[model samples]
Target: MSRFLLSASRLLALLLCAVLLSACVQDLTGPDDPDDPPPPPVRMRTVYDLKVSPRYIDVVGSCDKVFGSPTAGEFQYRVEVNGEGRTNGFESQNYNSRLGVVTGRVAGQQITFAPRTYTWSSMSSPGRIEAVVFGTEWDGAIRDGDMSNRRGARTVPFALGRRPGTVTIGATSECRLVLAYEAEWVQREVPA
Candidate 1:
């Protein structure tokens, strides 16, 4: 009888220990427990379609005849805003192939673009000319699903050379141009 009592006590002790352990675990990991781990951060992405227009502010040096005045034109762009508010996208216009990759940031109602540089070589009358284009100062604001007050500038500096090592002093020219961009929102998307 004493051995039977001992066995029953051991079983009861083990059952009580299991119950206490389960209760502790429930307190720590239950759905309603304050100590429960938070759910994965909600990720939200936004996409905007816009039509951008460019206008010339200034043209200088020999570029006036080469590039002429800025023509009235519009380009389409698809901009994606990530969860962290970083913007990345591409120009959907076929004529905009010359424009390089587009990257920027959007905060609240304000948008800005990162500076970009492009380099290429072309044949001039004398020889091959290397052109470096620098674009900067792009800023804009978003309002009522449209973008306004957008402005930017670009500089093109060229060096003309007859041979790999031969450069002509008078053949080089630098052009500065300013651009104003107006964007009309075509569409907006937010993933479910």
Candidate 2:
């Protein structure tokens, strides 16, 4: 009986110690400190639109407001005859450009939002909004205001153009349309 009591007491003591140790360690993933002001809100937005149908579209870009500094990126695009181009011009001029456009947040190196595919909701934190910019990056040109060649920069009044003809366009830009005092930029959290 005494041995049994001793063993039981030892087990109880071990259990108590384990409980106490676990309690001492708190969960680290709760809300941030209220005192710590949230990180600045960074968002990507479209300021203007470029229409390309006549083969020589014009682009004019500028940000009405700038919150912080951002880097400028570049993209490469191509022009085809309604998805009809020879990759090797010698053979058929079948070219595929994949239309590259380097985008970044309005200013920060890191982006707070990304593109989402939802039917009814609006775009969330994504940088470049997709609108039939109507131009190929080849003939497409951003004139006047020259953004820096540095990565992770932002440029206002980005004006780019493309040659006109049956044109369809999509984009993922990095410029943001956020005020300086926002936090945790959000886009369609979920895509449809």
Candidate 3:
């Protein structure tokens, strides 16, 4: 008829330009169907399991949080205490009943002081403190210049908070694991 109406008007303008170019080619990208790669970076350090009983097996203690590790650096976080369970003389610093055992590093974890404090010896040697929380109740751990007690087990010598009426000692049973740190970078809070 006019070459079949000009080939049906060029097939209706190529189907109306492929329906307006698929309506302006919209996809914006959302479902490529193959995504599962993001989760692998753990082991700087983060431990917390403080279980206390304290009725006195020579009283044990604990505090928590080692996560991602970063108290400052050089070596932050390492406070290990063990109140002689098998009694090799627990935390044996030559195990002399640890001579007036004291470990009080206030704010970051490590509280227990008394390296010999007596008004004049009425016979009072009681020391065990752990509870002063305004925002941070840490005892110790964030070392660099060798704070000693390098895991051979035997770390108790801090003092900052606790010494009045002091009564956290046993009649409670046992539980101690005080170790703290929060400086920054190198366990870098792990999120890369």
TM per prediction: 0.17, 0.23, 0.17
lDDT of 1 by residue, 1-192 (tens): 999999999999999999998887745454676777888776655443332232212222212122554322222222221122222332333312334232232211122344322222121212222221122212221111112112222221122221111111112233222222332332333543
- Cα displacement (Å) at residue 137, model 3: 38
Residues 1-192 of candidate 3 have per-residue lDDT tens digits of 999999999999999999999999868786665777767766543221222121111112222225833232111222222332311112213221224233333223344322321111111121221321111112343222122222322222232233121122212111233323111111112222
lDDT agreement with native, every candidate: 0.30, 0.29, 0.29
lDDT of 2 by residue, 138-174 (tens): 2234421222211121111123333212222222333
Candidates 1 and 2 compared by TM-score, better number: 2
RMSD list, candidates in order: 21.1, 23.0, 20.7
lDDT of 2: 0.29
- Total residue pair clashes for candidate 3: 39
Best-matching candidate per lDDT: 1
Report the candidate with higher lDDT, 1 versus 2: 1
Candidate numbers, best TM-score first, in rank order: 2, 1, 3
Q: Candidate 1: worst 10 consecutive residues by lDDT?
A: 162-171
